[model samples]
Target chain A: MKTIRLLTTLKLALFPLALQAQLELNATASFELSRGGDKSHYFYNEIHEGYSDWRFGLAQANLMAAWPFGGGWRLQGRLLLERKQGERPEQLRLPQLNLQWAPQESPLRFTLGRFLYPFGAFNGRQLPTERTFIARPLAYSYYVNISEKAGFFPGMGDEVKVPADGNTLWGSTMLYYGGYAAGMKLHWEIKARKAWLDAAVVNGAPNVRTGLPGSPNWGITSRFSVQPRHWWKQGFSLAYGTFMERADINAGLEKMKAYRQALIGTDYLIGFGYFELSGELIAATYRAPQHLPEEESFAGKALHLKALAGHGDIRYSLPFLGGAYLAYRFGMIHFGRIPGRTDRWDNGIKRHSLAAGYRINSFLLVQASVSTQQVNEKQWARRQQAFRLMLTAFY
Target chain B: MLRMAILMTTFLSFLYLGARQEAPAVIPGPHPAGVSAVRNNPEAEPVPLLRGDNEIYGLIGLPRPRKWVARGHAYNKDGSKVMHSDDPMAAPNRNVIVSLHPLDFQPPLSPTREAAITQKDQTFLPCVLPVTVGSTVYFLNEDQFVHSIYSLTLRNIAIGRRPPGEVHPRKINKPGVIQLTCDIHTHMRGVILSLETPYFTRADADGRYRIRGLPDGRYRMEVFHLDAGKRMVEVALSGGQALRQDIDYTKP
Candidate 1:
């Protein structure tokens, strides 16, 4: 209640200030109808069930207001609203709010409040309309656990599982240079808890008890992108974080050390549209004391790589219609063997995909694609096909 | 001496006859009190040329074709609607019903149909096109499948449409060279050239164009192809003059 009162008061105070300045509101929404094979199964499922889906969602509802003080001091604030679906319908949250100050056309900027953590290339620029793929890459979306059920709930002892959706929040400040061209940016964020690590462990583990932390105990991530030339774009990203507060009674584990991941990617456009290629390689290492009584070590690692090639549309501006293109991609993920162990646990997966699309206009798009995946063992092989109808509008 | 005097008299008589031939109407040289004498000379006044500008803009209409068999459609040749069949081996027909003409050249007020980009073995139907600015383009995925469209040009915008009766239309706002890509299909591609001015005309099937209604002026005419850059030619047009020129893009 007090938080609501404070928010109302802040709104009243800021409303007048916003009116004094020229404030602007920009919003976007997407209505998508999609049908695809099994949503819960791996990408390589041989036979799958199709289901109809409808998502009426807002990409952004941003209120931006800026005011100028004498002698070059300026204040700006952005209130953003974003939401995503979880296992439950009521799992909605506000993802951003920040107040910024720049001293009169100065190159330096300062920001305060809850904001996005500048970690990966996609994190900073995850606008829905800007993405080329109907869905984000599997590396970003897959293995992401958005449920509240405790980590150990799937297996062992009886413990009431708690939903861990909103366990982590982070604040970051960044200095950015180079407009759209080759530039550098530096950022730092301190998360409320290391919830991501907890989720990763629970999702990766084959068998684990219930009542584990659903959210990260605490962590931080950083990334950078560099465009050396007009045609060559490259980027590297790194995330190092930790999770604490373990309640597993059998192992008597209290806190585990963090894990780390490094990613590098490059894209090059060659010969106008004759040929183009892009690839990304990610290496992730996990470190935490294995709570087993016999083994107390902290070391595990994984490697993932994805690549795509495109031949630009050759037929454009037909008297009646215009533009078409074809593209293909191949991806693989491998899990490294644990230290002091030689057994290969069949920890690898490969995916091959083919897709084609045509542009009707600036406001509409239609695409269809088929992908096949192969896990380490043939039993897990899967073939999947999807068709998407998407529409986006901007004013 | 007598002959010389006769010759002089004859010359004087000719000179007098020349002077008497309408007395060279020169009443006065200049009148400073009234109007500017310079203005009275028609040669000193300039003719005002007409300055007019007009824009031609229209929509490219593509009525759905009859007797069409989309990837998932079954059509009857007897002019009756038939139920769509689930024949996996069925090949969708590529009979596009659209007109591809420059804005300056209008078809003789007669309904006509033409096939645009065709999905032959999963490729774009037309492969290339020459388009003028402010022209609306409609992309009908003539295949029995879906196609995702994207472009590399900064001004090139993409719109997505699926096959089997899906139509997507877009307007090119900028003039440039661009290539379109399908994010979904790796092998499907198309080319488009957004022209700056509407004074462009596409060559017919025989690679010919007869541009009319051109005012007398000098213009730099350019020809382009999907696989080539622009080839320009300079020409002058006069009133009631038909300029003949041939553009051959077959040269390297």
Candidate 2:
């Protein structure tokens, strides 16, 4: 068959490279169980199943492969496989595939292909296996209505709907949700003893159509960190980007009038002894044409709307507990009403989570968390609570 | 997914083509050129050993530090006094470096050997190690997580991180005491003592040391200790004579 011939050709092509280069393979597998209130939803709707009733979730696996060759070149790729749920169908997805050239002696480097956004700490620790808690923060996982037909306010073309079973809204997710984009990045760093200044410029948002090499949108990220004394490190970060919404692209829309989202955020991380504290604050503005329908407007003719979100968390390790730790996080997301809309129509959500984890061994971990979420509007103000337990293994 | 598959195919093809071509690895040139003429010839008449009747043997005694008088009281967890005074025998020892250098003795070339300093449970095993110059020390990580071992005192360069079960080797070519620290686990600290002379030994926990295989001659004995400080003395040895030199660091 043609498929068999192609497979044979591929194997032969990869055999030599695999043997010649230094390759490393790693994987993480997890089984999770969770339950949520009647009206709560999963922040990253594309990833998680559901959170309504007690459900025995299926196992999820992420496999990564890295090949480091001569000339400071490195190639890395990750494959994710999980069960089907919600609008996200079961499938094998390549979450990351990139090549990097960072020489050990140089302060400048370049990366290309699909790589995680270097905006904040969230992007740096995006994988579930690396996160301290079972769930992601609201600032990185919350959903906002970007549907041209139905906005987040009242009297839109179609009224925005929330799943009765407490599932995430069907809308455009946050930029940090599964933050990966296909483009190029230039990174630079200057180190002085224990301190460093890191900066980068890249095509921030994912444009599925106008993929690789370059995109219509771009962003910048920078961080400065220093340790004044032993056992302590503190750092701050600033990021800005303009994101394009592919779903809203139309032939009739003008380039300037095309719907696009702009974001600016500041973040910080501090670690001392057995304790670590980190937080981030972000503001996003979405602009549309002035000729849009009144149903999507704030002042009935406004062209832009802004949303503000913030998150903070603290974690501590108990030295006597062998490898046990506790973590707490608080997050809030606010959506401004259409320019002309009243305060009552504004949308927001607040979440608080407490989690504890025990490392059974280097490869295995057990974690449990309880979280509660509250909506802003009185109609949907029922405090939503959820409990989650996970067993994760990395090898 | 299709795009990724295409990308992978393209990358594989490129790699295969590159491999077929003469792609050479980049290796830096030799160290900076320096001109030096040999001052001594090994093929010439060898210098005879000390004209003595017998081999010289010696014992060096190390006295307790005088400033370290037992004063602190030992207490139990309940705030009750357990001991009236701290253990005198527990006073710090084994911190001294003793070396014997002859006025005309040229240290023979010593064979280089490899040694390992292991990382287990986020701590370094055998916290202090002494190795001859030109010897290589391999830092092995036994723990699951990655560990970074660096010495800024001598080389001023970070060796970077090594994963579990991996070994990172560094050849110590200079004679100096270097302190190693882990960037991730700040509590972990280690020391590597690189010595130029083969006739050197560190004192034991009881302040006793012995350096074997010395011909009958006069030696300029040099002693360096972190707590006891430094001391120097000239010792003359005759054939088959057992010399006993007791050093009282308490006065110095």
Candidate 3:
């Protein structure tokens, strides 16, 4: 509530300044409604039962304002207000709120405050309106346990197990893939507007259970991209971070509190005529729990986990229809297995998606997608199929 | 689960059918500023069709096709290897303007015939435009926001701010190229060609052009395109000659 009030006050203050400077104030609201179904023994889209009913997927609004004080100084603020119906709470997020300095004749820029993480295209894809599909990429949606005790399976202990359907976190220990981060960033364009390099240091990953501290945990991310033509671009990114939180890993053993993660990714995009093609590859490595329950650890051995994920898609515009397109995507997530590890949880999964969308105009879009997910291992040989339809409107 | 899938499929089918029934006009794609030869919009109001007695119909052949630049890696659909070609693909030279110099002939109508250039989705429709010397061109703001249309040509004509649904008309008193731009959108640009003659036509994607309503006599043909700059040639037409002039405008 206090944060909301502060944001509202800041917006009110910027209104007069906007009028004085004759600046453009941008505001848009978007809504998404979708439904999906699964057909596997263990729910297709989750770690537990694989079924989720129809729901209002997302409702969000974006507000932004920028003011330039000549001589290379500019102030800009952007807020994202989201109402996650059945997923989480209604919250306000500051995607970008910073002061920037860029010399009039130079390509270098310095920024401070909360800014987007310059790791990969996934980190910057925070809005549903900007994404091509209803479901996020494979790596961005995967979940891993950060607890000290051995993670529970479907038929674990007497404790009640809840279905983890794209949401729900055990504690501040686990990690949520890429989102927004706060820190100082530097950007330099090397060769005109064709190439750029960016580096930033931000508060640790999205495992912020205890809230962001003054200066305890920090992460570093960097990216480089080159656009040789007006319609083509390619880039690479890297991120390394550490999270320090205290949690009881095992009941009978001492608690483990520290963890680290690293990532390397490459992305490519091209648009020619009425067709577009894009793809991304991400490889991540993270530390395993130091102490685990006797029966939970794989052969009572602790080992780091590594995963490789990638996705590629092709979209073609229907020449007959002004703003309609058809797209097909293929993605896979492969998890490395430890020596003598018997658990199937570390197996690989692949997904194939086909979607069609029509943009009514500049502010409205309707899309439908059908996808199939299958595990790589034959022991877990079950295929799950799902379908989703979404309508998004922005103003 | 099967029932739900069937229901969703039915709903989507209905939506698709409904959308197919309403074919909306789309804004043209973005182009580099001040490139008057590129017209990316085909949905704009069609040009008045040419139907009369005499016509000049022929393909404007290029001496050689423009070569495609090999930049960063451009992969094929299968992601195997980058597709490279030694020669250019089919039909390279497009958007070339073919006109005749109006020396002795007079235009049929006054320049009062008005044509519109609209602002939609932050892009100026009909990026490459041609009109008679006295024609009035109206710049209409069809977008949701305001746009300032200006031209820095000879006299520096500036049409202040035009709000949505408003139109600003400008008269062309002389024959010259007037480059139109928007102060708000740096990428929004267009060109207004004020020709003294009405016998002007743009070439199709296949480099074929046809200018009708020409009298049977000798005339000078002027060709304008981005790649080859400008060139002129002389041709004569007799009774029902059906002038077939294939011009290879590429410079040696």
Q: Chain A: TM-score in each candidate?
A: 0.57, 0.79, 0.77
TM-score rank order:
3, 2, 1
Query: Worst lDDT window (10 residues) for model 2 chain A?
Result: A149-158
Q: Is the docking of candidate 3 incorrect, acceptable, medium or high quality?
A: incorrect
Give every collision pair in model 3.
A43-A49, A43-A50, A44-A50, A148-A249, A149-A249, B111-B134, B111-B135
- Evaluate every candidate with DockQ and list the scores: 0.02, 0.02, 0.03
- Model 1 alpha-carbon drift over 4 Å, by segment: A1-17, A38-90, A101-111, A114-116, A144-220, A244-251, A257-276, A289-325, A343-346, A356-367, A393-395, B1-252
Model 2: fnat (fraction of native contacts): 0.00
The i-RMS of candidate 2 is 24.8
Clashes of each: 63, 9, 7
Kindly list the per-residue Cα lDDT of model 2 for residues B43-125, writing each as its tens digit.
11112232334332333356554422222121001111111112221233544557666665666546234444666655554
Query: Per-residue lDDT for B106 in model 2?
Result: 67
Q: Which stretches of model 2 miss by more than 4 angstroms?
A: A1-20, A44-51, A82-89, A147-169, A193-242, A246-252, A256-258, A289-302, A344-346, B1-252
Ranking of models by lDDT: 3, 2, 1
lDDT of 2 by residue, A1-395 (tens): 99999999988877665556655566777787777776655443223334467766545777777665555677777787765432232666776788888776676667777666555556656555567777767666665655332223332211445331243224444464555566666565555335555565656432122223444666566656655543344556565555543223222334532445566666765653345567777777766433233332222333577788888877655423435567777788887766664653235877777888876644677888888767775465554677888888876
In terms of DockQ, the best-performing candidate is 3
Docking class of 1: incorrect
The model with the greatest TM-score is 3
